[model samples]
Target: MSNSHYDTSFKGLCYVNRVRMVKPSKSDPYRAVTLSVKSGKRVSTEGKGDKPEFTIPLDCKVVGAQAQAIFDQILEEHWDDKKPPVISAAFEVGDIYPDYYVGTRDKNAGKTVPILKGRLLKLHDVYVKGERIDTPVETADASDADTPAAAQPETASAETREDRTVDAVAEEAASFPSVVRLSKDDPDFEERKARLKAEGYRWDRENKAWRRPAA
Candidate 1:
């Protein structure tokens, strides 16, 4: 692993970071290497020895080996496979180099996503052929329960609780016996109601509904 540091005078060991990459062009077949050499952040327009530099995005799962090798080969004037390297390497739109697409190598479908540098690639709201993967449920468990998200039970909607209509709402107004009016003096009426709720509010299983103390 030769350090590609840009200090022509002093050079021995250098480390490179994988930033974003772009697609390579015909003139510059080899992907452009965006490096932070001593000259600051600049794109290597011309690959080693007069060959045009490539420009590719870096969001794909490009292994450290592939990236480093690409850089080395381009810098030396020795491109093995001539006709526009089919790009066997992984690349993505935002990857640091022209490598592989992130989701392009998902061989096992939704079972697993590739772990790149200890980071998992997530595809949320995923589905296949109009079939959704995440199902709708209710009363599985408290959302905040200490359980791995993968193993956590799916939550059920409130309507599934009492077989109530999904669009229905149970307002406490119907249960009130007296006219509970609000006054300008108590501008923070909602706060008082919440405080009272925190104190204690329970449902009576026998009554089949909620029960509140007289105000």
Candidate 2:
């Protein structure tokens, strides 16, 4: 709302651009405006290589200019990549910058390790795995077969019928499934193999989850 917000020449003021911003400590939320960045780059330290974002440490005074510099450096590094500008760091709070004050180090000295800034500027929507938070699609609906509506009373009771179905299946496997103990090379082996093949079962090396090989 002030003129300095527009006047970007003030060195070291860092800000996420006109991106949907969320505060980590939601007890006090900041109003989103076009963020201004400054000179240096942010650092990352995550292992899974999570898309980096900015985070204010629990006990630190992050100067606006310092944050801006790091944010600008990150953006400049990826300016021509043709993808959404992203910070190339693993996932962790420390991934944004060093535990110590990295800003104090003189650039004239032996080049210090550059920090990886995260892309906290553009948060358009939130997702869990691949599903959107609002208007969530049911996982059962994601399957090829239609999820049959389980029978329930018009006037419901406290009992959970869904749990009952699972319990019933488990009980059947525990009790009656042992009746026919046949190895993989039984007379019905061909039929079983054909059924498994039809189901598109394949061995997954990374995760033991059986899946059809990608086409």
Candidate 3:
């Protein structure tokens, strides 16, 4: 357990090996996912460490229903034991708090470790000894309606409020650098752009697409 902050970019080939769960006195256990890179360098403000392997502990047991559903979707899509799913991850290390039920060893000790909160930004084929696993992983893309909105009862209302809040903030900040793009050729391009417009997104004529916040 170290007090050092892990504020660094951790981009590498890694695996969502497993989830570490912690139980409370009388509640469902909370789970934290363990992401590991067999060989990679840890980049921090102090400097970069040529660490052979970097294990990142992320807090995935989110509180909000919408968020938890998203996290669950991520897990269901990428984490499977029968056929290990590999991924190319791009993330930055954040904070790791002292917890009584977390850590590789001594689950109840309340150890403080540098936690790297991140997401599986990209999914890749599982490779062992530089060979791809034959068992095809399910790459079916799930729609937004299939997840967050439907996963929780409060998701639609919560999202509507959130969208309004973001819209208000974006308008007040006017110049805020929070924009993204969508191609006009996309199947739902028009509908998507219209929805984004209502959510504070705008058309970037220069980019030939719609734009919105990174969030």
Candidate 4:
């Protein structure tokens, strides 16, 4: 299998016990949250009338400012409840890789068990019980009235801006060619190159271009 990174999105159940903050060391004070998302499908068993559900567990880490903030809010809301909340969320993950570790439980003791691991890039929506959470909105504070309107930064609301940005990006991506070439002479060459790489395009040395097959 190739080691190239790719993006994936899914809906899953997140148990409180499987979520926590991690600080590697005092020297490297960067913080991250680990989330275990359970997702799967049902499969019919031979000679059985019912379909048995199979669970696929993805152990992922959430980093970045926006994603981490969302994670923190979820923890703060339900971390200490008498009945731990099982959160349902839509997750966008990236750079997924196949990994394995020695199993310590019965039957699979001392044997390697495969696992899927990735970076939690974004959380589209979250729910506890049946109520939706994770709404991304920034409202103007009452104190803002005291400040001069001209001095206040001009920016679109978070939720509206993000939604439009996602839609724009999706529309642009759909118009992309199977392969893209860039010239250093372009003013935005560097920025476009970075964006292309993040979108799974690889530099083709021979062709002097970035290339990726169309989905």
Best by TM-score: 4
* For model 4, the run of ten residues with the poorest summed lDDT: 138-147
Stretches of candidate 4 off by over 4 Å are 1-17, 25-52, 138-215
Better of 1 and 2 by TM-score: 2
Give the per-residue lDDT digits (tens) of candidate 2, residues 98-152: 3333354577354444433321212213232333333212222111123356697
lDDT of 3 at 44: 48
Give the per-residue lDDT digits (tens) of candidate 1, residues 113-186.
32322111111232222333332222222112233345656587776756645345344434443323333378
**CA lDDT of each prediction against the hidden true structure:** 0.29, 0.32, 0.43, 0.56
Q: Quick one: best lDDT, which candidate? A: 4
Query: Candidate 1: global Cα-lDDT?
Result: 0.29
Better of 1 and 3 by TM-score: 3
TM-score of each: 0.15, 0.17, 0.29, 0.46
TM-score: the better of candidates 2 and 3: 3
lDDT of 4 by residue, 88-189 (tens): 666656667889999999999999998877766566567766578855443332113233445756587866665547779889878777688777799998
